[model samples]
Target: MQWIECRVHTTHAAHELIAQLFITHGANGTVLEDSRGKDFTPEPWTDIIGKPKTEHLPTDGVVVKAYFPDDGTLEATLSAVKKDLVQLEVTTNQPVAQTEILLTTVHEEDWAEAWKAYYKPVQVSETMSIVPTWESYEKRREDEHVITMDPGMAFGTGTHETTLLCLQALEHIVNDGDTVIDVGTGSGILSIAAAKLGAKAVHAVDLDPLAVQVAKENSEANNVSERITIEQRDLLSESSNEQKADIVVANLLAHLVIALAPDIHRHLKVGGKLVVSGIIKQKEQEVIDVLKQENFQIDDVLEQKDWVAIRCRLTEVGGE
Candidate 1:
């Protein structure tokens, strides 16, 4: 399918708001690129040696991409993105002289095949290996572990930086017989990982109904269906449960993570760790600050590429 690359350039202050606005309005597969990073930092999050669950992913400037039909609607979307645009260009139809955007077409099969080239077996720490569903590996290859995952449009394929950071954090913190909950458990990777790690019980919650079904199937495929239960729960809302967990792991958007910080802390036992991810580097501090108000002690930070994952532990003091 051909894609019209609508380029919208804005300051770092407006990046998140504009990108989110466009995607919410109707833009699909929005890819954000950092044109001029003013509030950027130098050192990478996983630069420290001996950090667990650290993956050596490419270090690229802030860029988010989304896919959508090339139509006039892009103009409206771009306008909604920001009032100030140093450069605004759209690539559509036959290349016009006035348009600065690059017009490129991609066949659906070709794009899929291209991504397949990067699909390789990933050793998630020493105990777990994340293998693509379509790929094969010899199990008898001495202590090799495998978690087969095929990310079908739903995130958390164990390939992204945030997921790997979380998985690495899990390896360090998760203990046997601990009651664990994976908020936004996509493809049941985190939930299944917890089960495989010997957690006494696991609850995988997702707001999307389809994700619930997908997670259930994945859990069954990994033979952890009995241990991990997939349920629909909106963490943003207050809900009463007969049980709270010893650990809560949420790999969600940075804003949602901040908004749900209080509830996340409430649902955890004292000193329980909350592993949070799916945050871009630019927004990591915002999430950390919000959690701090709820008496969460910032424990560890993991960064891969431009993404970040944080581990926060509930302190004896409840909240501010």
Candidate 2:
């Protein structure tokens, strides 16, 4: 089996976003190379393939390398990726340091196992940790909430700055017997955490079919499938006449957050909590402004690295 490696050179700020773009185009795995990677701590594959070369990484930028199966859609996928990268730059005002999308052909064994080294037991908050299915982790504390995850082709590890921020915000807001809605629920990590935190029921929705499937599997793996319903739906569309939720969580980009803000009140009960994450540093204020316009009262603001998550409460129902 062969694979086409799409290597993108971009600023550290855009590295994660670019990797996400590749995933949206069907890249099964991604490896982000940057100065911060020194702490990756490779183990199993290190002895087999030797330590990954870190010294040769671009001095001024991060390299996001993604692997797509060379099973005949390379031309179309590559074109789509390029087009999206351009739109991303315009949509979010994200600076693209390099435009050349470098491609390299390699064997399946080259990356199939290497990327697993990237995921480890990451304690997203004081009470919760994301442990990959391929890893062995004992509870740090008796009450520690362990979420078993294997994102597969869906492309989230629950450890990115945006995800970490959302996890923390959920910890502060989710309550027992509360109904929750998670929009753009990649890998269903947030939904699972909400269930563990006592949310009576969770409706997790994502537009990506792969994400929907992966999330359902993760939910079942964490033993919270009974409480969480995973489905593929676009939250950007009109909301259905379903039961209002006590809380809503969206770990999506800033533009989507802005576009989805007005409709959020529909899914949430009056004064219900809203946990929003995945906003890049540059667009934080833009998202805040949008939320405020929709009658959301900022309850808390969480920031880490270049990402921010806002916890808000629906002040009052504007209308039905």
Prediction 1 TM-score vs. true = 0.68
**Candidate 2: stretches off by over 4 Å:** 1-3, 13-31, 37-59, 80-99, 104-112, 236-241, 318-320
Give a tens-digit lDDT track for model 1, residues 59-140: 3333344454665576665555433232222322221122223334555456556545555666666566777677766563
Per-residue C-alpha lDDT of model 2 across residues 1-320, encoded as one tens digit per residue: 78788888899878868888887778866766676555444222122122334564566678888878888999999899889988989987977748588889887565436547655666667788777787877885898888998756436466667787888888878878999999988788899999999999998887777678888888989999999987778873533428889999998888889999988766788889898887888898899888988999988888876679999889866632
Candidates in order have lDDT scores of: 0.66, 0.79
Model 2 lowest lDDT segment of ten: 42-51
Best by TM-score: 2
What's each prediction's clash count? 12, 0
* Prediction 2 global C-alpha lDDT: 0.79
Give me the runs in candidate 1 sitting further than 4 Å from their true place: 1-115, 139-144, 236-241, 318-320
TM, every model: 0.68, 0.83
